[model samples]
Target: MSTFQRFRESWLRPILFFGNNLLSLIGGALTSASAFVLIGFYLVDAFGHGGSRNPYLGIILGFFLPALFLLGLLLIPLGILARHAALRRAGKIPSVYPRINLADPLFRHGIEVVLLATFVNFVLLGTATYRGVAYMDTKDFCGATCHVMAPEGTAYPVFAHSGVPCVGCHVGSGVGGYIHAKVNGTRQLIDVLRNRYPAPILTNDLLPSASQTCLNCHRADAWIGDKIRISTTFDDDEKNTRTRSLILLHVGGRDLTGKLSGIHGAHLGHIVYISTDTRHQIIHYVAKTEADGSVVEYTDTNLKQARVGVQRAMDCTDCHNRVAHSFDTPEKAVDRSMLAGAISPELPFIHKESIALLKASYGSPEQARTQIAASLKRFYQSNYPDLWQKDQPRIAEAASRLAVLWSQNVFPFMKVTWGTYPNNLGHNDYPGCSRCHDGSHNSASGQSISSDCSVCHNVLTIDDSNRSQLADLGVQ
Candidate 1:
């Protein structure tokens, strides 16, 4: 007989003896079942024309099933060891395992079955593992699949960076990153199962650095000159008096002439700061690195002594923190709707009414929706009966729009209310640009960080009804 034949014949009897036990038999059955289920899921995902977009289904196929498959794999070896131990304890093990008769049809059939099963197990394991990891990296898995992420999930589709995947920001781009994400995900899963996760999840420290994620698409050296911004708002009066503001934003960056010019150019890689709070709104120190490698440090004069906080280099996310999941303030949300004609500005006190309803507290979104719509209708019915009857359709439209706006901005279940997350792009509603540019931070030689209005933006018009300048500039 050949060497392979001799080895197989010598080992086959013991393999059969050990694997015939109940534990090993059960392990084999479990392994076979899990493998088949995984194969079925893969086939459906591959051929079902977009498959099932259901998030829960993905959890099963992506995470739970794969875990089951791995457990089954582990049990196979454990069962073999248990069987070996049991036989030795019983003193049933012979001095040498019996040699098999290769010529016997039963032994030959058993060997053929084992070889085929092993080959199938290897193939399925590889395919299942690859698909499971790929599924976990999907946007749905990160957002819709997790209850704690509902607030972000609701806000993501409305923002500028909706096209990008969550992993683009949360996970790094290599084998190491993949491993880290999976390990973190496992811990998160455990927390979720135990109902121990924090509401309104904070991810400031959890995110990968901007260099690994954001810089992949937006280069810091790219040039972008000044840009104009026009904003409109309505007063709380009966007429809902409209006013507009025109501002020129100095969104400077590196220019084609190879000179760093604007806001992005000034801060992208040249600044470091200390934030004394989790939100990074309370900046206590600022340092600018000069072109000549000289560093000038500025300490916040308001702070009695230099307090320790998170010290880090400034990056895109420092300013554009809400680019992907931005929740608008009540005023901004109402203004956008009225501007879009979803909420009629023709209705008296509509802006004021909308703001009042948006700011009110409620136990849940459904309750908020019902209460807001009923409250608006009641206000019109009680105060302006004639107008209520005449413009009922407009009132209904406004109520529906406000209810949606409220739901979009507030998540009572997650404890995410108005301004739960601060946008650091500007200083209007939050301490954004003013955190470092308030002229309070002074260098040792008495140089202060400039708070001058003209440094960042120039306000051409403030709360004016006139659009003549915007018209003249062809931006109206």
Candidate 2:
């Protein structure tokens, strides 16, 4: 026989033998095909003109393809082992191990196939691992996959740190963090599938250590200085009188002199508190570790219950809980729409009417949208028939804006509405700063958590009818 003929028989004979078994043949074919296809797609997506900008590319390359590749790879081994066990039981082979002869044609072919398969398996394994990890790190995997996270997914894009990844804050650094997140994610997935997740998803358990997450971007010691804030509001009056508040916020940071001052500094390294509730809204005990390393404990006079074992150190999130995924109240939402000219301020009682309509309960988002538009239109027609008839376009535009605002802030399916999640940034809307600094928590020495308004910000002007303050500041 020619050397070529001998090599062909040696190399190709055993591969054909393996293909005789339907299960093994199918599994092997699937495994090899999936690996090659995934590698090709990934290469194209990574280097192509569209790049990663296409959302579906990530879903395919990171999630679906990798999953199929892993599944096929696993099935290949199982099918081969099953086929071996069956042959042994049926007396086709004396034992599970086939006779090995280096010079034999079958043995040579088997060895070649094994080497090639091993290399293929190794490459596929690496690809699967890479894609799996990348998929889990995506925002879509976290927010879009689960219906419960729909509200967060919708709000995330408009948040201050919209560009920041969800995992950046939720998942910590290191192997332990990755494992923990995966395990938690699995549990959440199961909960979602089983329809067992809580309404208005509570994040207390999932909240990562702020020191590890928040501090990655914001340095507690960095000098922030004072921030100028101007709040504009309009009354329910005919003129839709614009009122403005000019305030200088004392956002001082750790100075060169080693003094911690202002909003961030006040609690960054000095404050710790214990809350009696799950939401951490009711703070009863507080301990301030002064710069001298002395600790002063404070207790709420009205809190008759004993302290819980849990004590949380004050962090950026404690105050800025809604920094991301913030839900605005009807009043604030209307004010913003009016300020942006989305909702016509020229309409009589537009602000008041919008607020009233938004506050009224509805069954679903669709119903809310329809009702909001109908309600607003009805108000204008009933109250000011002539105006509503003359300015139909303006009324329709205002109604459309109000409907969008309602949809953004409220999710009836999730049982999330305006004010559902308390924003701990300020005291006006929620008992945010007042939770600890309500002038109620008193130390043993009779010292209270400072409720002084000027400690954090100076009231330059508040609800000024005249635009004089704004004019002087060149803001109007």
Candidate 3:
């Protein structure tokens, strides 16, 4: 007889006897199906370049299929056990269990098949695990899947560091960091499933140090001496008079003479501070380590208690917190749009109308878009019929641009309206530099943190002539 026939009659028949019950048979089918599906997914992912392009498809193949495969694996053994117990209770237990004889070729062939199957399973499991982790690391997996992160996710794509992976800043490098990030992600997933996630979710407190993430791209001592910034504003008048402000920003770093200079250099030394609030907007104390290792402590005189909050070392993100996900104020947005000629300055009271339209409340984004455009058209058509007749298209275009600004910055669903998250870069809008530099923080020796106007920037002219200094510099 053939070795296969011998095996089927002897070893295989005995082994199959236990799994002949309905539950075991069902489990066998499920296991077979799941294994085949998993293998198919792996093959397609391996050869299909980047696998499924859709985020939902990636979630299914990466997470759901593997879970089903595991479920099937567990059910197989459980079904076999239950069947054996039922047979035993009915007094149908076998007189002898299946015997193994290594001397027989049938036993040897069956052993070989089991070993090969095990190896294949290991390969599949390893690949699936690797691919699953890789998929989770992607930006789409992080931002697109989570509803609570909508505000940041929407702003991220249009920002400066859009190309950088979310994990690149959020997670530390190496295996430990990867495992930590996964554990945190799993906790977040649980929160999302339970609908317990907070609206306008706060920034994570346990972020990796800026040295490990930010310094990889930005140099600490790189010099960028002085930068001239021109800001234009239109007055709320019949003529919509334009005025420009030219400021020379001291954005310097370390010079060739090894002297630290400018804004960057002043902040490059070892420094620490205490923030009373979660968002770090209220600075209570500041301490700077001098060159000789002397620490100068500067406590806010306005604060009653000196050490009442979270103490943290100073870093690049302390000021540039919203670099990757900045939401502009309505005034800033209008200024940029007008400067780009997206909203015509020639249109009467376009600045005032745009700001009012943007700041007004609406139930939804669609409503905001519709009402903003309609309101602008109505105002122009009623107040300035002559201008409206000549600049109908201009009014429509300006309204559309305003609508876009509102959509980009405001999300009613997430309760993320204007100024929900403050940018700490400037002192005008938020308590940015003034948090510590408002002439309030003083040392024991009566010296206070300088809040001089010229410390960071020198204003060349405020509300100067209509002619731009940029045009004079041949940079129109």
* Top TM-score hit: 1
- Model 2: how far residue 383 lies from native, Å: 2.2
Model 2, range 130-180, lDDT digits (tens) per residue?
A: 876887787877777556888888888898888888898888777887788
Every model's TM-score: 0.95, 0.86, 0.85
What would the per-residue lDDT of candidate 3 be over residues 1-476, giving only the tens digit for each residue? 89976876665555556766677666556656766788877677779764477877778777877666666666766777787788889998777555556679997896687567657766766777777889888888887777677778788998889998888888877788778878988998899889887676776467777887788888988989999888877777766777778889999998888889988999888989988888888888899998889989999998878487677988888888887888988988898889889999998888888888999998877898899989998999899999889999888899889888888888877789899899988888789999989998999998998999898999876787434555776644
Q: Which candidate is the best by lDDT?
A: 1
Ranking by TM-score: 1, 2, 3
What number of clashing residue pairs does each candidate have, in the order they appear? 2, 0, 0
Off by over 4 Å in 3: 1-31, 38-51, 74-96, 99-120, 465-471
When sorted by lDDT, best at the front, the candidate numbers are 1, 3, 2
RMSD of 2: 4.4
Clashing pairs in 2: none
lDDT for each candidate structure: 0.85, 0.79, 0.81
